[model samples]
Target: MSHENKTIRNTAPGHPRRPLADRIALVAGATRGAGRAQAVELGRAGATVYVTGRTTRTRVSEVGRTTETIEESAELVTAAGGTGIAVPTDHLDGERVRALADRIDREQGRLDVLVNDLWGGEHLLVGSVFGKKSWETPLADGLRILELGVRSHVITAALLLPLLIRSDAPLYVEVTDGTAHSNRRYRENMYYDLAKTAPIRLAFGLGQELAEYGGTAVAVSPGFLRSEQMLAHFGVSEENWRDAIAQEPAFAVAESPQYLARGVAALAADPGRAARWNGKSACSAELARAYGVRDVDGSRPDAWAYFEAAAHGGEEVSPEDYR
Candidate 1:
C-alpha cells in the first residue's frame, strides 16, 4: 500500500483545529512503527520533520524488516503536508547523530520537538528464555540494545538541546512502553525489559534536568499498538484488521501507531504541556481523551485499562476472543 492511502482524514466530530504549522521536528527511528506514524502526523500538522533511521533505500538495518524505508517515511510525511527530510542515521554512532543535529542547526536554527524512538532488540530476543528463572543474556547483545535504545536518546538530546531551547514551545518525547509504576513484568527475555525500562527512566531524569532549560520531557507509550510488523504478524491489514480480532480478543481494541503519533503532536502543540511532564508515562488512549482526538476507527482503545481489568479478573476476555 502507498503512504498516501494510509493518510487519515480529520473527519471526527468536534475535531480540534490545526495548531502546529511551520514547526520543526526530529523523529529518530522513523523507518517504521510509532516513529513513522509520528513523523507523518507531525507533517499532517504542517511541521517540517527530519525523519532519521538506519533503514533506507540504499541500506537495511540489522533487524532486516524491509516493509518501510526512511525515504518512504519522508515521502509519507510530505504527503501529509509538511517538508520531510530523510537522514539515514545509525543512532549508535554519536558523531553521526551530532552531524545530523549540526545540519538541522545550520538550516532551521531551531527545533520545536524531538522524539527518540530508536530500538533494535527484536532480533536479539528471538531465542531468549524467560520462564521460571531469568538468565543473563549475552552482555554484548544487551549493550547493543542499550546503545540503540538508551544512549541514542541521550546523545540526540545533547546534540539538539541548543536548537530546542530556541523554540518558544520546546518538547522532548521519549517513546516507551507502559507507565512508570506498572510492576507488570514483560514476558520477553531479560535484556528486552532492561532496554525498555532504561528509556523510561531516562525520560524521568531528563524531565527534571530540562526544567531549567524551558523544555518538557515525557515518556509516551502506544496501547496494544497495531504497528506494521504486528499487522503482518497477524496476517491482516489495517483496513481489514477487524478480521484478526477473531483470533485475539484484544485485537478488537488494538490501536494504530498513528493514534499515539497524533498524541505526541498534540502534546508538542500544547503551550502548558510542560506542567504535565516529569517522569509521567502516558498511553495514547489517555492522551486522546485529554486532547479530544479520535482514532482512525473513531473509537479510543484503552489497552492499559483493558490489561488492568483482565489482570484483576474484571474482564473475562481472552486474547483469542479479541482477535
Candidate 2:
C-alpha cells in the first residue's frame, strides 16, 4: 500500500447503501476483524474510507499471523460503494502516524470519522498465561500487548485530533472488547484487561474534551465478535461456527464484526449522536434499536446481554431473547 491515499473505484456486493456521500472516515488497523468490517460498512454507507494497518500484500505485522491485508480491506470498502484507500501504517510509530495525518490533509483535507480499533495482541494469547495471572505472564509479553493494543490508540488520537476537529460533528469510536460494567472484573489476564479497558476511559475523556468543539467520542464494545482471528482459532468457518459453541459455551452468542461496524455507522449517521452518546459506551444491540439495522442474518444479536448473564452470571441464555 502507498502512503498516498489513492481513491479505489471498485464494486462490492452486499452494500447496506446509505448516504454518507461526501463523508470521510479512517479505520485504523483495518487489515481484518472489526477494523475491516467497519471500513467496509463505512464505504457501504457511501463514505470515503482510509483503511490503515501494518499488514499489507508485501509484508505482515508481527502481531498478526494470517494472509489478510489492508489492501484487501480497502478493496472491499471500494466494492461496497465509497472510495477506499489503503495505507500501511504502524500506529505505534509517531512519525508513521504523523505521515498519515499529512497524507489525509493532502488527500482529503479533513477526517469526519475515526475508528481506533488497533489490537494486535493475538500472538501473546497463545501458549501463555495471558489471562490467568498478569504477574505470572512474561513481562515482555505483557508490555508488548500494552504497546500494540493500548499505546497505539493513544498515539493515533493525539496525531489525528486536528483533522477530526475540522468536521461539523466528528465521530470518534474507540473499539474495545467489553462494556464498562462487563469489563469491571479482571479479564482473566492482567495486561489484556488493561489494554481493553483503557479505550473506554479514553472515549470518556475525549468526549469531555471535544464537546465544545461539536465532536463526540464514545467507546464501543462488541459482543463475542466472531472475527477472522476468532474463526481461525476455533478451527471453523462461519457456516460451521456452531462447532465452536461445543468447545466453549460463550461462543453461543458470538456476533460478527459487522455487528459492531453497523453500530459505528449508526453512530456516525445520527445527527444528535454527540449530544446523546458523548462520554458513554455503546454496544451493537443498543445501536440496532436506535438505527434499525440488523446483522447479515437479519437478526440483531445482543451478545453482551446473553454473555453477561449466561457466561458470567451462570444463567441460561436464549439466542432469541438476546438477539
Candidate 3:
C-alpha cells in the first residue's frame, strides 16, 4: 500500500507509441515477476490495470518473499500513467474472484485484457531436492501446485470472460513456459512439467472457446527471466547477475521479466492479434524479433534457441550468443 517505487520514464526510442489509452486490464497475479512487470507495462501503455494477488501489505502468500506487494504493483501501474486498482484476491476462491469481476463491471463496465500469471509452485517444491524422484514428492503437494498454477487461471478466466467480451479487441495472455514445440523434460519432474504445461493448455482451450467472440488468447513465456525471487535464490543483484552464472549457468542467458512484459504489451496493442491465437504459445525473444522490440539490455534472448543449443551439447551461452 505504498507508492515508494513509483517512477516514470518516456517510452523507449523506436518503440511503438501507447495504444491502450482508457482500456481496462486485469493482471491476475501481479505481486511479482512477469505478472508485476506486465501490469506496469500495460499501465504505461495507457490501460487501467487491476492487479490482483494473494499478497498485500497486510498478508503474504506461501512464497515467503515480499519483494513487492499488490498495492505497490498498483501504484507502479498508476505512476506509469494509467489507473491502477489493487484488489486482494486468491483465485482459488470462486466467490472472491466473482466479487472482483463484479467490482470491475460496476466501475469500468468492461475489461480489455486479462493476464493469468497465477503460480504458487515454490511452496510445493519444498523438501524435494532435484535428486528425488517424482513419487518422493507428496501427492498432496503436487495437487496443491496444480490447483494454484492451473485451476486458478481457469477460475479467474471464467469470472472475467464476460467483461473481456465487452471490448472490441479483447486480449487474453496466459503466462507460461516454453512454446508449443519444446520437448525438453523440464528438470525430470513430472508435477513441475504438468504445472508449467497447464497454462498453455488453458490458453489453447480459451482460444478455441473465444474464437467466435472476437477475442484472442495466447500463451507467452519470458526468456530465462531473472525474477526477484530467482535473483535472491542466486544471491545476486541485477548488476551482479553475471557472477551467479558460475554456479547456475542459465543465469548467463537470463533476461529481465520486463522484456516479456513489453512483448505482451506489444501483442495486446496489435490489431491483428487474433490471427496469432488458436493454441499457439510464443516466447518473449520470438515476439521481440517478430515485432522489432528489444530487451532493456538491448538484446533478445531466444529461449528455444538456447535450450536447443544446450540439448545438442553446445557451450554455455549468454545474451551475446543470441545477437
Candidate 4:
C-alpha cells in the first residue's frame, strides 16, 4: 500500500493528491472508447493530455463513425483536472502525424507518455471477417484491417517517440485487446490475429531499444471492455449494461473502459514503473490490484482472472476471488 497516498486506492474522501502533476501525455485515437478513457484518466492524475484522432466536432474520418469526437474527448480530459488539447489528424498520414509531434514540441516541449491507442479496424473485428475463411474474405478488406489496426500504431509511434524520449520518465503503452496468454487462442482470422499481436511484439522490440533511453514500453489489454462501440453494439447504456446479459451471457463479465484506463494512469504515475512493467503484456484487472483504481461503480473488477478460471480454465471458483 505504499502508493496509497499517491493513488486514489483506499483514501476516497481523504486523499486529494494528483501524482502525475505536470506530466505531458498523448493518447492517439482518443475519439472515444478506451482511448478516450485513457486520456481522461491521465488528466485525472493531472497530466496535460493531447487527444488525437481522425474525428472532430465538424467532420468524421474515413471510417465514417460519428457521434463521438476528439474535441469532446479533449473537453472530458480538461474536465477531469488537466489541460487537454484536441488535435484532429489521421495517424496513417505521415505528414499529419509528424505535424502533431511538432505541435506538441512547440507547446509542451516534452512528452512523458505516448499511448498508441489508434486502431480503426472495428469493421474487420465484428464484420464479415468473423467465421469467414481467409481465402474467402475480401482481400481489400483484410489489407484495410491490417493498415488500420497495425500500421497506424507504428506510424504514430515513429513520429512521437522522439518527443517521448526527451522526458526523464517516458512510457509507451500499446493499448490492445487481449493479453499474451489469451491471444494465443487466435483472434478471428489471419489478418485479425496479426493485427492484434503486432503491438505486443512492437512493445517487446521497442522495450529493448527503449531501455537505453530510460523508457518503458508495454502492451496493455482491457478485459471485455464495455466501450462506447460495445455499448452501441449491445444496444445498452452504461446504466443498462446488465440488460445485455440476455443477448450475450458472456457480457456478464464486461467491465467499463474507465477501469482499464485508470490502470494506464497508475502505470504512468509509478516512478519505478519501467523496472516492473517494461516489455510486459499486462491486463487491466491485475494492474487495478497493484494500483488504487476502480471502475465506474467503485469496485475493482478483475475480469481477466475471472475469464481465466471460468471461461478458459472451466474451473468453478467464486466470482468474489477475481472481482
Candidate 5:
C-alpha cells in the first residue's frame, strides 16, 4: 500500500471548501481513464479516496499500458486536496478483494462512497469482438470480457458493501459504458452487450436493497470520451483532438474525462441526490445539465443525445449544437 496523506486544504487559493471532507471513498480500477478522473475529482471535493487497480509503479496489468498506475492516481488525488491511498488490488481475485475490505474496515470503520469502475476490456475490442459474430469470437476473450466488466464489479460490491452500509447515507456508483436508454439496440456482440448492460441491472437491484439503509445506487456513463486511449487511437493528443474530426466526424462531440468527473463529483455533493438519482441511469451530459456543471473547456457535450439523433436520420443539427 502507498499512502499520500496531506493536510486537507482548499482546492484553490481563497476558495476553501470541503463538501465531502468527512467522506470515505473507494475507486476501483482507478489506474487511468474515467476511474482515475473520478478519484481525482472526489479528492478535489475533500474525500479520502482509496484508489485501487492491478497496475502499480512496479507492476503492469493485462491491459498492458504502463504510463498510468494506481500510485500516480493516488498522488494526483492527494494533490487535489484530500488524502489518497493507493492499494494494488485485483477485483477479480476474491481473496485479495476480501483482504482489501478488511483493511478498509480496520482503518476507516465505514465507507461512504463506492465507485465500481472495473472494466479493462478495451484491448479486446478491435478484431476480437467488434466485427465478429459470437461463434467466431474467441471463447477465452469473450469470457474475459465478462470477468473484467461484470464479475469484477460483483466481487468488489460483495466484499465492500458491509463497510459501505455502515455509513449514514451510502452512495454506490456503477460506472458502465452506456445508459439504459441508449443500450436498447444491439451493441454488436453478445458478450459485449451483456457486459455493458449488467451494471444497469446491478444498480437497479442494489438500489432496492440499499434504500432500506438510506443509500443510493445509480449507473453512470460518459459520452464519446476523449480518453488517453481514444486519443491514441485517433493519432492525436488532447490539444489536437479536433484534428481527428476529419476522420471521424462524430469526434466533434467527444468530451474530456474531467467532464464526467465533475458530474460525478456534483452528484456526490448533492444533498438531494438520493431522491433525484437513486435507481436511475444517467449519462455525463444529463448529470452536467442537472448539476449546472461544465467541462474543463467550458462546453457541455451531449454525445449520446447526438448519436441518438443521428441514428434516426436527423442530421439537421450539427455536432457543434450538442456541445
Candidate 6:
C-alpha cells in the first residue's frame, strides 16, 4: 500500500480542532512501531514533525530491520496533514544529536514537543537474555540495552531541550514499556527492567526542572502493544492477529500502536495537560480515559488492569473485559 493509505488505514475520526496547528515536534526513533505512529498522530494534530532514527533507505542500524525507514515515517507524517522532515540520527552519538538539534533550531527556531522513543534493544534479547538471570545474560547485551533504552534518551534530551524550552508550552514525553505502578514488578530480566524504568524516573526529575519554564514532562507507556516487532514475534499480521490468541490468551487485550499514539497526541494538544500529568506516569488506557480517545477498533484496551486481575483477583476474568 501507499504510504498515505497505510498511514491512515487505522486512524479513527479525530478532534475537529487543529489544537497543535503551527506547533513543532520531534519524534526520535520514529522509524517504525509506536514511534512512527506517534509521529503520524502528532502530524495529524497539525504539528510539523521532525522524525529521527538510525534506519534509512540507504543504511540500517543494529536493530537490523529495514522494512521501515525514517524517510517513510516522514512521508506518513506529511501525508497525515503536517510538515515532516526525516533526519537520520543515531541517538547514542552525542555529536550527531547535537547536529540534529542545531538543524532544528535553524529551521524551526523552537520545538514544542519532544518525544523520546528511542529504544531498539529488542533484537538483543537472544538466548542469553529474556528469561535468563542477570549474571547469565551477557554483560555486553545488558549494557547495550541500557545504552539504547536509557542513555539514548538522556543524550537526546540534553541536546534538544534548549530548542524545546523556546516554546511557551513545551511538552516532553518519555515513552517506555510499562506504567510506573505496573512496572514495580520485575520485567522479564534485570537489564530489561532497569532499561525500561529509568525513563519514568527521568520524566519525574525533568518535570520538576521544566516546571520553572512552564513545561511538562511525563512518562507514557502502551499496554500489550501490538507493535510491528511484537506482531512478527507472534508470527501474525494485524489482519490475523486474533489467531495468536489461541496460543497466548493475553493477546486478546493487545492494542494497535495507534491507540497510544492518539492518546499522546491528545495529551500534547490538551491545554491543561501540565496540571493533570506533569511528573506522572500513565498508560495508554489511562490516557484514553483522560482524553476520551479509543482505539481504531473503537475499544479501549486496559491490558495492565486485565493482567492485574488475572494475577491477583479471585473471580474469573476474561481478557475481552479489558477491551
Candidate number with the higher TM-score (2 or 5): 5
- Which scores higher on lDDT, 1 or 3? 3
Give the TM-scores of the predictions, in the order they appear: 0.87, 0.92, 0.90, 0.91, 0.94, 0.94
User: Model 6, range 155-251, lDDT digits (tens) per residue?
Assistant: 9999998888777778999999998899998988999999999999999999998887778999999999899998999999989999999989999
lDDT of 4 at 169: 68
Lowest lDDT 10-residue stretch of candidate 2: 1-10
TM-score: model 5 vs. ground truth? 0.94
lDDT of each: 0.79, 0.85, 0.82, 0.84, 0.91, 0.91
In candidate 4, position 149 carries an lDDT of 84
Q: What root-mean-square deviation over C-alphas does model 1 reach?
A: 7.6
Candidate numbers, best lDDT first, in rank order: 6, 5, 2, 4, 3, 1
Colliding pairs, model 4: none
RMSD of candidate 3 to true structure, Å: 7.0
Candidate 5: how large is its RMSD? 5.3
Question: Which runs of model 4 end up more than 4 angstroms from their true locations?
Answer: 1-16, 316-322
Error of 4 at 17 (Å): 2.3
Clashing pairs in 6: none
State, as a TM-score between 0 and 1, how close model 2 is to the true structure.
Answer: 0.92
User: What does candidate 5's lDDT look like per residue over 223-297, in tens digits?
Assistant: 999988899999999999999999999999999998998999889887688899899899999999999999989
Residue-level lDDT tens digits of model 1 in 217-287: 88888888888888987899999988887788777779888889988888877767888765568888788
Cα displacement (angstroms), candidate 1, residue 166, comes to 2.2
Would you give me the overall lDDT of model 3?
0.82
Residue 197 of model 4 has an lDDT of 92
Compute the lDDT of residue 118 as modeled in candidate 4.
81
- Tell me the lDDT of model 5 at 317: 69
